[model samples]
Target: MCVQLQAKDLLEQPIWRTAELIKQSKRHVAAPDGYVSSFIDFIELHGGEIVTAASSCRVTSGFTDWRHLGQMGVDFGWGNPVTVLPLSTRRLLGSDEPCFFLPHSSVGEGKGDGGFKVLVLLSEAAMPGFKIEIDKFCSQEFGQL
Candidate 1:
């Protein structure tokens, strides 16, 4: 379907809330297309960001939310799934910031507690400060932030 991305202080959000927001956004994703009969015409007049799921999809700045298909108990007759690895060959189109959301690993050593893993890409100039901010969040217990 479609989804909207609204900026927020992600690092401070609890995992459950994050998941809830994602679930909620999934519902509104297709609304613009269905509600606006001249959606294409509207985009043509106003311009819009291109969204894609291609392995090589690119974005100047955006996020990929894999949580919908993530953590599903998919099996290929290899027994119960022990983990899920989310990846893509896509590179940031021209954006300085991009983020990927993937499911957390299985319990015990691989467990992410109750949260998922997020892969964030930022410019070299921003890494140091970003690292500090992340460190602050990680200082708490697994689900605390």
Candidate 2:
């Protein structure tokens, strides 16, 4: 169910947006716009150097079903994931290792000051470690550090 967004001059042009629909056995509702906005804004504010306009929502099966993205957390238990959706290009910037946003998962609302910033994925080889870290974080203690 993964999609790739080819970049167009530093922006992911052919983007794929997922719908927000989830049931964690607690809440059965679609994710709010605030959550999505907060995420996109956070990246821009932090110098994402957005070469293209900001975007949210997804187009799937001839329908824009952004609501299904909620399963990224509610069903997958990754929390409010602000996935680093690769928008196309692998630039020779940022981390020196081809700066790009790869899809990732987390708990709680992302970047809205409701969830902790976790994981930095840039390659396929890193996924196993990422998941391990996620599990460790979830099992670890949390509170005022």
* Candidate 2 deviant stretches above 4 angstroms: 1-89, 92-119, 143-145
How far off is residue 72 in model 2, in Å? 22
My TM-score estimates for the predictions, one after another, are 0.48, 0.24
Q: In candidate 2, how many Å is residue 89 off?
A: 5.5
Per-prediction count of colliding residue pairs? 1, 21
As a TM-score, model 2 comes out at 0.24
Which candidate number has the best TM-score? 1
Model 1 segments more than 4 A misplaced: 1-28, 32-60, 92-96, 110-113, 139-145
Model 1 Cα lDDT, one tens digit per residue, 1-145? 2333434655576778777877776665556655244556766776666534343533345577666684556767875466565354344433336677767767577454666767787768788999898788888785454
What are the Cα lDDT values of the candidates? 0.60, 0.37
Clashing pairs in 1: 2-29
lDDT of 2 by residue, 1-145 (tens): 1222333422533222212112221132224544355556777787645422313422111111233344345434644545534343333222212323223344344543433222233456666886786687777786331
CA displacement after TM-score superposition, residue 6 of candidate 2 (Å): 32
